[model samples]
Target: MQFREIIRQALYSLGANRLRSALTVMGVAVGVFSIIGVMTALEAVNKSVETGLTSLGANTFQIQKYPATVFGSGHRRNQYINRQDITYPQALVFRKTMEGKASTIGFMLSSQANQAKYADRTTNPDVVLTGGDENFSASNGYPIEKGRNLTTNDIRYATNAAVIGSELAATLFTQGENPLNHSIRVGGEVYRVSGIFAKKGAAFGQSQDNFLLIPITRYLNHVKESGSINITVEASSRKTYSRTLDHAVGSMRITRGLTIREPNDFEIRTNESLIDSFRDIERAISTGAFIISFMALLTAGVGIMNIMLVSVTERTKEIGIRKSIGAPQNSILRQFLLEALILSLAGGLIGAAAGTATGNLVALQFNLPPIFPLLWITISMAVCSAIGIGFGLFPAWKAANLNPVEALKGK
Candidate 1:
């Protein structure tokens, strides 16, 4: 039989056993769905993060007591916990030391779930309150939309001045109301609104403009005294950025009182490092998804093999009659193999579509754009085709090698 004729015969056979074919196709679909769904969601989140990180500006890095992301356990986890807090005094000293080497060095800290109130209207307790120095806005890419930024004097005096984000501004003041020079209650303390930040849209479903900012000194004194602070540093020039990172590392070690032989106790995070961390997480998730999909496909492959074996048995008389006439062994083999390919390829197409849709739904919840994973679709179809060949070969060979007289006599 010709290849097209073989495929046509295969389809007819599959159509004859509709329920069995559906069940077999379902197994392959499930396997494809597991991996494709996970990968699509991960890709969407990664894209969102990349865009958000780019808005943090260029040649900037941050220092903190602990790494932004932690992996591993036991001694490594405890080591990070045991590190001393990056004190306000230490931050001030570092700022003084790096005066000529860095463009802007800002100290910052934050408290979440604090309420902000203007007269009778109060925002939800989920509001975030941040404390930073004069250069905080410049270092953090927060452009002042109205009024002026906090002055050095504010940090020095630990003044009750505040800069609110655009979202917060809208919440606190009426449409035409100028928030500058107005007092609003944040965490039960009244602070004069010194400036309002430009609107920054949401990332990962969380609003970037939902927080209020105050002087870092005021934050440390009133919000929480003994906690660690994050220090932001911008390089003086792009040419010196790498050297600046090395200089900052050495300076931080000195500030923290670490000896030559002692290991440094803080983490330095740059835009590149943050991206690398996220990629590492993505790899881990991808690995897990691969494993789960492997198992599911393996089971599906077995099901295909079992169903093919049954098909060979049920069509014994037909096979014998064809062989008794002019049908060749390879023709019979091609027919069975074509049937398996049809089932697997159909399942792969369905599963890829379903998985992409499901993953986009998850991405939508996080306010990320929908993504169609073309690479995964190609890979799934290729893998499904391989599964077809791997599992179908034996049964096809069995059907082809059967004794025509014996098969016909079996009734």
Candidate 2:
């Protein structure tokens, strides 16, 4: 049969059952919409998360008590006792042991949205308060822009000195008069601004430049309840990362008193490990999306089959009349198959458009760049069309094979 005849038959059949065809098309559209929308949103957020994880320099690794990504709260607290602190002493041991292999820097951050006062000047509470020991600058890439980095002497004597990030400096001090000698009150104690940090821009939607770095010793004294004292280890190079990590873990396991067979209680986090965690989350989301979308598609496929069967039944006498007039069996089958394809393709286009819009809308709200899952959209539409053909086959074939006599008798 010619292409024009096939199309004519498709349009006539679909238009003849206008409301039913629309409802069936809506079902397919919903399926594609669910999966495509989710994929786009996730791609945008995943990009943001990856940028955030690698915000710290590539060579850096951190040792702490908890995993980098904490899911649904209170579970960690309830399941484990002895919420150990990676003590200052333990970190010192790690530093001494790692020696030439990796550069170890000890830090402990205590963040509070506390008021900052400088005479009549009041700063916002959202400012980050980071506390680092002597090696903070080298290991974490926080180079000093003005005054010297914190020294062992500073931590030893619990010095009342602080370093401001570039953004925080701008907010507090005016006209580039140097914030180095100025004093700011934090938690009711006056701390002299000893240095200013160069701007590092935003990391994972949070401003990295909006922070203050003070001696870790002073932080421990002031914010007595800081959870885990983190030890950051910068591996010698990317090539040596695995060995460096293994060496750190082995040494830490020995120092922290874990037996050969025992698993270490502490967690070592790196950008790659953080990515693995995100992968787990992404997998879960993808699985849920597949299940939901598949159910919708399955319903649509059943609806297509039902509609195809009804079309075959209603056109019984037409099939008999066509067969008597020498219409080939393959042509009859082609007509039904083409009709189903047109329905699926129509729904797929509308669904792809809707999904893209919804996904981009969500990304915009989260301050993330919009994403188009073009590959997924293409594959999904193709799959929907394939489903229509596959499911409509039996009914189409049955209609093609119907006995002309019985069909003409209106059975």
Candidate 3:
């Protein structure tokens, strides 16, 4: 038979058993959906993370008590815990030491889940309260949109001054009402607004402009007294970044009183390092999704083989009649294989469409651009086609090899 005729016959056969064909197709769709959906969402999140990491100023790196991300056993957690806190005093000494060596140096301490209140208008308790100095804005890439940033005087005297984010400004002060010089209560302590930061939008589905910044001294005095301080430094130029990082490390070590024999007791986090950490996480998740998808596809392939075998058994007499009529064995084999391929391809198309749509929802949530993940979709369809051919081969072979007289005798 011609290839087109075989395809036409396969379609007719599948339509004859519509319910079974649909169930088999659904099995294949489920398998494809799992991998495609997971990969699509991960792609969107990866893009968002890359964009967010750029919020760090150019040629800037941060020194902190812990790594950007910690993922390990209890022993690893305790290792970070046992290290001494990067104290406020240490941060000050480090800043003084690196004063002329770097272009900008800033330190901050933060507490989360705090609310800000202003005359019957109050924000949700998800605001981040931070203690930072004048250089904080420059190092952290937050340009002051209105008024002025905190000054040396604010930090020196531990004054009740605050730099509010755009989101907080919108929530507390109505249109035509200025936020500067207004007294707002943050975590129960009143602070006069010193500046308003430009809108930075959201990252990872969380608003970046929902926090409030105060002077580091005021933060140390009013907020938690014992937390670690995070120090940020900007190299004067890209050419000097490496030397500056080396200098900063040496200076931080000297400030922390670490002997040359001991390993430095703090973490240095650069944008590259943060991106590398996220890449590690992304790789792990992708591997897991691939494994799951592999197993699911393997099971679906087995189901295809079983259903094709049953189909051959039910058509034994028809096969015998065709063989008696001098039909070629290749025609029978091709027809059965085409049926399986059609089912697999149909399911794959449905799954890819559904998965892409579902995954783009995550992009919307993170305010990121939509992702097509064409590579994954192509691989999925290819795998589905392979499954159809590999699993249908044996059944198709059995139907083509049947003895005409025995098949006619209902054997």
RMSD values for the candidates in order, in angstroms, are: 2.4, 3.9, 1.8
Evaluated against the true structure, the overall lDDT of model 3 is 0.91
lDDT of 1 by residue, 200-287 (tens): 8877667889998998888888888878889999998889899888889988888889999998899988888888988999999999
Q: Give a tens-digit lDDT track for model 2, residues 274-381.
A: 889888998999999899989998899899999999999999999999998898999999999888888887878888889888988867755676688889998998
Order of models, best TM-score first = 3, 1, 2
**lDDT for model 2:** 0.82
Residues 262-289, model 3: lDDT tens digits: 9989999998898899889989988988
Better of 1 and 3 by lDDT: 3
RMSD to native, candidate 1: 2.4
Candidate 2 colliding pairs: none
Best by lDDT: 3
TM-score of 1: 0.91
Off by over 4 Å in 2: 16-18, 70-81, 112-126, 143-153, 166-194, 201-205, 239-243, 259-262, 315-332, 357-368, 401-410
* Residue 153, model 1: Cα distance from true site in angstroms: 2.3
- Candidate whose TM-score is highest: 3
lDDT of 1 at 354: 93
**Who is ahead in TM-score, 2 or 3?**
3
Candidate 1 residue 144 C-alpha distance from true site, Å = 0.7
